[model samples]
Target: MASQAFEEIAETFEFLDDWEDRYRHVIELGQELDALEEEFRVPATKVDGCASQVWLMPAVKGQGADAIFDFRGESDAMIVRGLVAVLQALYSGLTVREVLEVDAGAELGRLGLDEHLSSQRSNGVRSMVERIRRIAQETL
Candidate 1:
């Protein structure tokens, strides 16, 4: 259940014939994200198990399972920041329950990220997803 914004990215990935072009597109997506405020970059929001420093701040609206789930994230590395943006596109605007239900690996697989990313990057992505899932669960 990808969001419309994510679906658009996936479609663009499909149109891009080479991994280089897709990689550039991912970086471009990251550039579109608002800079995460320095105050929110504290340890409380920092995601563990990421090779690159990463922070994710939850922004839930309402309450319980129906609460809307959203987060702002940042990373020291450019590609990792893009990965955060991808995660944002994947999870933003979904309800907490919907966020919990997302098959992130499967959704990202559509973009061939699994094949393209390095082992460390893949682990970082997994860490980000786990953090997001935990946030959604806590919201519920």
Candidate 2:
């Protein structure tokens, strides 16, 4: 599953190719993600300590292993928004434990994201992933 997600992420970045294109793709992915109903959209689903406004909604698809996630994020910063989309694509629809176990920092680094970002921006991206994992752990 991780490998599959990795491949998907690689494809995503490849599809975008350039920084401008990447940002557009990210926002596009966010647009593609359907928003959850208001009832399930609670404070508990919110990811804390993020530089961008981020909301995460987790749904158990079937049994204990199948799970799905819906992420809604808005950011004044375009790159930050793109970063959110990367997380959504890689981690959504994974099992709770699988989501928790994703090493987003490493994954992002492997994808050469940090090289393209400022230190502060990279930190913000890390904060988003950690917070998402925390939310998943809380729900699990």
Candidate 3:
């Protein structure tokens, strides 16, 4: 289900005329995410080294089925939230191999993102890819 959603998001990008509208769409999706508050503790084990606190919880139905990653993140930076949304859109539903196959850097380039990002934002993205790959490794 989530995999289909991701592909649809990619298609949405395809439909966009330019990066301006695409960024608005990205921001909108970021707003859609369930933000974790002070009272909420989704767990830190799956929280990777994000500049802002990020939570990732995944469930596996069975072999060959994709994992569903439930994410919650909070950051002062709106762009960071948008980056998380991009990660969620790309990686939420994927088999271990599929996760391994995802070219995150390439994907970022395709989105016309990352080049103008600050060092901190770049680090945050690296953290996300590391966490995701770590999860994928664990499933193996």
Candidate 4:
């Protein structure tokens, strides 16, 4: 099932016709996210290929097909942090298979972010998704 968070974000983006307003909303979402603890911000959890320092920690609940993963992530950059929030909204509490199946890039495109973000930022988003998928694959 799609997360309520994802739906809410999409709706908010739709309601905000201006890209500037949407960007502000994304930044606000990042500001509202709970910060990851210092201990969890280790080299092991750090995401590569991002211009800004980013960390992701994953926790699995249940077993087999019933399993759902929860992710906590943080980034030094404001926009990057917002991107992390979006990823969390889309992927957290989803089964490993469901996480893999989600077309995150397409969703991002739908949000009109693909055209708005710099190439480096776009690549960073891809890197984050790759890291999440890798974690899911390893757990499976």
lDDT of 2 at 90: 71
Query: Per-prediction TM-score, please?
Result: 0.98, 0.67, 0.72, 0.95
Model 4 TM-score relative to the real fold:
0.95
Clashing pairs in 1: none
Question: 107, model 2: CA deviation in Å?
Answer: 1.6
Query: What is the per-residue lDDT of model 2 for residues 21-136, given as tens digits with 9 covering 90 to 100?
Result: 66566567656555556765467765566666555565445443335543455444556656766777677667777887777777776667878777777777777777667656
Q: Give one digit per residue, the lDDT tens place, for model 3 in 1-140.
A: 23566667777878997778887887787888777565554556435566666655554444442554434455545667777777877776566677778888887766666765767668878887787777676766
As for candidate 3, its clashing pairs are none
Off by over 4 Å in 1: none
Off by over 4 Å in 2: 1-6, 15-17, 35-46, 60-72
Residue 139, candidate 4: C-alpha displacement in angstroms: 1.2
Q: Indicate which candidate wins on TM-score.
A: 1
Best by lDDT: 1
User: Cα lDDT of model 2 overall?
Assistant: 0.65
User: Which of 2 and 3 is the better model by TM-score?
Assistant: 3
Q: Please rank every candidate by TM-score, starting with the best.
A: 1, 4, 3, 2
Model 4 per-residue lDDT at 54:
94
Q: How accurate is candidate 4 locally (lDDT)?
A: 0.87
C-alpha lDDT values of all predictions: 0.94, 0.65, 0.68, 0.87
In the predicted model 4, the residue pairs found to clash are none
